[model samples]
Target: MSLGDENDGGQTRTRLPDGGTGDVYGGARRPARNSRSLITVVGVVVLLIAAIAFANRSGTGEGTSDDTAKGPGAGAPTSATGVRPVTGKDGTIPTGYAHDEQGAQSAAANYAVALGSDGMFKRDTRHTIVRAVHDPAVVDSLLASLDQAYSGTFLKNVGLNEDGSSPEGLTFVSRTVPVGTKVTGFEGDTATIEVWCTGLVGLAGEGSNKPVTETWFTITQKLKWTQSDWKIQSSSQQEGPTPVNGDNRASTADEIAGAVAGYGGFTYAR
Candidate 1:
């Protein structure tokens, strides 16, 4: 019930993970699933993508310029929702995102979640998700490029049994976590934000090869408040201030598989 900036309107809270990153996604629908196998595909896709910048030690903009201290500004909206398997209107896209510079940061965070979710893997859902997150004018452009990026053969190779279905008993999991957001610039409803993120991707099934892995990326979005919502005008991503992976024992195939089925996702705000 609580999670956005206070002065703004309650929205989503940034996760503030190590090295900076955050993410969210669809968790209710599953055909079969997998996790490890996702690592390979995600890594390759990230490495080859166009480079861009969002927030950083040297970014410009509206983030608390007090040297990246801690917490939202004193004038923030609310707090984090802490809800899982998230759904509905807030679940569909970000809410209570600020209308100014902070709004841009919120947009970058939400967009990172939208970009790194399971929704991107499927054709129809991907289109819907893209339309929901990006500005109307650029939706077609983003969709076209993404459509080409996620081709039919690509889906099948990554474990989807064609038609965007997971293999017999596996579930496909793709999640991005926004570590933090910093506004580099703002002018009117048009603003620039860099959302730092870390991602978890893979299929959670037996004999999976991708074994869930993690990655660091930052998404820079040029956002505009169109039709009364913060929509992405254009966005680009790149590698990060990445940190070394932890040595925690990787979750077993069954554990990871079951969790995706048991847990859920959330609607983010900031």
Candidate 2:
């Protein structure tokens, strides 16, 4: 009988031979219950053992050899190097990267941060940042380019004063956080690095037309080793590897402004 069929009293019933000793197919003896149970137990034990072996191979188990258990391939994109961050600073930007791949990546990341900062919206700080992070050969041209980009018209459109200051009771937010860095090319004195970044930019205040918003972009920096540090020779940015927005509630303008004022930016490193 079909398993779904029920008797009149709403109970299911199955027909069996008089002795209850035959298989459903009739006349064949069924395997012993203990044998079936044993098979199931063995299957479960095998799976458990496999899981344990995998865990140990991945370096999570005691007595696993460090060398075989974890290789360079095991590291995540955001893995830490355990090396201390550069101690030197030019103004607020980190400086004195090691003359190696790690140093080049660190300089590129920090440069991306400085260039995407609110300071770049203002003239004097913008100049300071440009000069500090760029090669001397490119500094003048870069300054001119940046000045034109942050012109009064651009500033006004973004709800900033001619001097790049926010209007009364408003806060202009522009900040870039580096998500990761990769060195695409590294020669003796030059390196090309790409920094994946997410940034915030807009005017935050009640009744403001330009509410603070987020953007994702990657900045590719061609760096030159000069003056005992890595400096940007040229750079370009392109939008996103953007992620979908989460279901968090948007905060008030006041909260955004307060947070900006309270939290300081970091000096990024590899």
Candidate 3:
């Protein structure tokens, strides 16, 4: 790798680029000869040619391509697995997700919606959901912890009765809409997923003290593939990757309650 060195005034001088030479004894410089300048130019052209040739060799043929390359749908704003959604349900919780990454993602998304629904406020429905979606080994402990967490004070704060029911002529509303899901980890039988969601909660009716309001959050769940499907092993939630509020006018309580009664929720899948 020796390119040789130039001698200038008894001191070694590295050749300057582009026909420039300098004798740095005390600061007197001279331009290089035309022949040396031509040599430098030729060397630069050779290097460029070599680089281009190497790049061409490493690339695909002009007409050849990766036929299996996927498109942007994989990371698009709204995407689907294109597989049929799960139809099976254990009580109200969706079940029988696929045994792969997509399945894990679907299970997590659906579980987030279920856990954030109005049903979870009530003791009976909460128990049913816990048993259906969670692993059997953790169900009892999870139920006990959840019961303590959803105390009477918490229920009243959300405009629910002491028993997690709505008062007469008032409607209790809690709904979660998953914005997206991501599978952060996956292995043979275990997976971790995070679901980003927007939720609506509070009372909606005439003279209601609490009007329906929206919030954003993310739920992360560790899942185990059991019984040919994904079941939640453990889960934790945190406040969201929330977006700024939009300019839409707020709906009246009666309108919100009417919409909730009129519309039905969808079963989500990846």
lDDT of each: 0.53, 0.57, 0.55
Which candidate leads in lDDT?
2
Instruction: Estimate the Cα RMSD of every predicted model relative to the unseen true structure.
Output: 11.8, 26.4, 27.5
Q: How many clashes show up in model 1? A: 52
Model 2 per-residue lDDT tens digits across residues 1-270: 001111111111111112122122222233222211111111111110110000001112233222221221132255544245677789998787777666677787777677667777778897887788878986775566556656687567556899999999877777667676666777869877666777676666665656666656666667799998898776555546677666555676677778888998655634
Q: Which stretches of candidate 2 lie over 4 Å from their true place?
A: 1-76
Summarize candidate 1's per-residue lDDT along 177-211 as a digit string, tens digits.
66666666677878766666676666676666544
Location of the lowest summed lDDT over 10 successive residues in candidate 3:
48-57
Q: Which ten residues in a row have the lowest lDDT in candidate 2?
A: 48-57
| Models ranked on TM-score | 2, 3, 1
In model 2, residue pairs whose N, Cα or C atoms come closer than 3 Å (at least 3 residues apart or on different chains), thus clashing, are none
**Which of the two, 1 or 2, has more TM-score?**
2
Backbone clash total, candidate 2: 0
lDDT of 3 by residue, 116-235 (tens): 667777889888877777778767766775677567975665557889899898777766776776667777698776666666656667766555555556666678888777887766
RMSD (Cα, Å) of model 1: 11.8
In terms of TM-score, how similar is model 3 to the real structure? 0.69
Which runs of model 3 end up more than 4 angstroms from their true locations? 1-77
